[model samples]
Target: MTPQPGSYPGLTRRTLLVSAVAAAGTAFAGNGSATAAPALALRSGSNTLNADFAWARKRALDWVQTGKPGTIPSYWAGLTNRPAFYSRDVAHQMLGAHLLGLDAENISMLKVFATSATERRRWYPLWAFQFDGGIYRTDYKSDDNFVREVPAVFELTEKGVRQYLWTGNRAYVDDAALWKYYTNSVTYFIGAHDDNRNGVADEDGTGKIFQGVASYNENGEGLLEAGDGIASQYQALLAYSIAQQARGDEAGAQASARKAANLRAHFEKNWWSASANRYIRGFTKAGARTNFGKENSWFLPMKGLTAPGPRTDAYLDFVHKSVSDLPPFNIEAYTYLPETFFRWGRVDQAWKWFRYVADSRAAYPEVSYTTIGNIAEGLLGIEPNAPASALSTVPQLPSAVPWLELDHVPLGAHDLAVRHDGNKTSALTHHAGPRPLAWTAQFAGRYESVLVNGQRQPAKVSVVEGRTLSSVTITVAPGAKATAAV
Candidate 1:
């Protein structure tokens, strides 16, 4: 008889690989000192006062667990009661973990997972692991019997690039295991699962999740390929392209880029449903399109796969309505919404969902970590290219926040402070770093010039998500300050 997929009846949003069964000897807190306080801080003053932001920040930082001597760096990103970190949760929580100065943990967790996706396992990494680098047996009875989903693989691949951008960690692009994993995720891994030969990974002719489900929405019906999975694949391919370029493999980079473009083009052309007025959720094993709203439907735009236009706008409006009318049972899943709204320039919606998630669940580790990340990456709009010694700020300050400041934001070698006074004026201070950073100050709408350090500079204009933006790049030396205003 065939083995059944491990059950997770208690979890509304189960892991890509997880088991409901409890594993003995794994029932302990993380293997680390819980005393270390995160150096990262957030502040709000004047009209921009919102205690919710402060509350979430503290709660997020408070969850940090400093690495111990004998174990790899670790944190709690999975079930609050479990002594494990999950790939799905960790991939989602990574940016916040990095901001909290948990770089070692991020690197260790990512590398361990990368190293685990060997040929023997068909390129699927173990879903979760104990803090001490041991596979969490609850989620893994054996390679063939473990639960596995499609989105996590590509999400991990993309997140590796995200971490590299923030930390400028050469290990992301240079590490042998990580580089191999990234390549395999986009190539051999996808190849192994593509039953239709459509250039996208689907189920391996088996509908059973233990064999590999094609979606993050574990409960979805009969899915052979999912929007979330394909969207993640697009991102992973693009990330692999960037990794290739970073490694000086220009030809490989071009090839990966082409693959990403083709995949996106194929998705756009085929995935949209004329009758539904939205993209279908996934395809069934019977080769039928499933029209539904869930991770499968929303992840398309969330992954930056959808082009900015009326279609995207309509879909986002639908998403906001869907979540607002009926919030998800799994609060952890809500963490993805703010980033979704922020990506499309819907500031008010983004903040609403951010605050909502913050207020809803405090125990789930991903909630706290994502709250921290959404504020920095979403509201403050901090984008770092540490490899180039550069940073960009596009403040998405809602009317509710008139002024906000974040201090000790780790950007690779630099610990910088950023403040947003509404959406018009912004400031950056290079608190600590080895070299000056090229800071790009971006403001919505077109302007001939912007005031930088009280001096006028020409603005470079561009359009994104159907909104005009004017930006100026200024160099901020260590122990110095620079301010930009429209």
Candidate 2:
């Protein structure tokens, strides 16, 4: 998991004490019962599921592209400020994300790493090495050979291997070298860290969660301290837990399983708001944790990998609160917070001192964003415009562009048919409900034009998604009570 250069603050003595005590207590928290294996759901319907299918597609893609096998050329170019190419980080990210969902694309993506020589030849040892353990918050220059010296293994990469096996690619099972790295990474994710110069890399005795990794956010709010995040950890746990079962390392696997099981407890106790039902960004030694970030605190529940209970309701409420009544950018939740922090200061200065607040706000304005992985990278996946639920049925690959066929919809917003390729324009005449008298399309290059309620909305609305609203928007009429439902 990559920590942020987007700085926040350090913990005070009181907060640090709480973290210490909390970490200690959590060791005994979760139910010891072994977690059951994960399975992906059968392909359901088209893009018309009750729960916005497009949104789910975007996140699932993120989970895959970032987790395991797929090589996302874009994230490479975007983050490192270099030309895009397949890399290890994106693969592991993609792999871990799809383990539970059993998404075909995700599975297919992971299989690429496990079964294909294509991946091995392109991003091998670095990919494998990065998987087991390595920190990559920032990019490295090729001239800087020192990048090789400090590279460490990550437990997440190991956790990912367990899921990779589920793909049933026999070729993967035969590769002894790749198989060994997968197992070793799992061992490290569950065991203690070796930061303290202990002979063996097992120094997790502080009773802290997963052997702590000392880190700093240069542009940070407080001083450097501990690491935190549930998204990556949970993904890793799911992967490792299964790997242990497959490798017959029952003890090691169980221990990792317990750790994974306890994550919700750790998250809830330290980062959760019993009052709000919302999970926050990871804690510092300090008591102040923010409600938003690049990833959702509710990933455990949102994916339904595990049950959520009342916490689920509370989390949804929290999500409702954090998201704008009228969204300006269709950003996946992870990227929303920085924009808010820089702009709005929440209750009680609640988020004033947290990491990346000042910089994120200052850096992005007059401009917002869209950080998609890649159309082809399996893990750390990508969304094909407003894509259908399953890509298999669609003849063409999803694109960033959208094509709308509104004339046939009769007056239904959900029924508007769209395509990724070619220019499609059709007029829609609303039966009832207020139309947006004045409006705007949010993105730039992604779209060019869209016609609203026939009359071809005046040139005032900025062109973005070519024909449709960028990222499936919910439009409202100016100074009107009824919102334009999409």
Regions more than 4 Å wrong, model 2:
1-81, 86-89, 92-138, 141-166, 170-174, 184-186, 189-228, 248-252, 274-277, 296-307, 325-486
> Candidate 1 lDDT, tens digit per residue, 1-486?
111111101111111111111211121112211124237777876332356556666776666565555567788778888888888998998888888777778878999899999888889998888888889888887888787888999999999877776777768777898988998999899988897899988875355666678877777475888888998998888777767776667687667777877887787789888877787678875754635557887898888777668988988888888878884568877889999888777899998988788777578888878988888888888876666667788889888778889888887677789999989999999987767888889988899999999999999987654667799989999999999999
Clashes of 2: 47
Minimal lDDT window, size 10, model 1: 4-13
List TM-scores for all candidates, in order.
0.89, 0.38
Model 2 over residues 1-486: C-alpha lDDT tens digits?
211111001111122222223323222122111113222121112232212223333443333334445343122212323222222333423322332233233333333333322222222122221221232323332322112100123322432342232232322223465455455443432343334322122222222212222211112332111222233444455444444444445576556656555653454465555554455543444554545422333333332222234654455445445543434432223332432221111211212211222223321110111111111111111111110111000111212123312111111011111222222222122222222311122221233333444323322222211111221222433232211111
| Winning candidate number (TM-score) | 1
Prediction 2 global C-alpha lDDT: 0.28
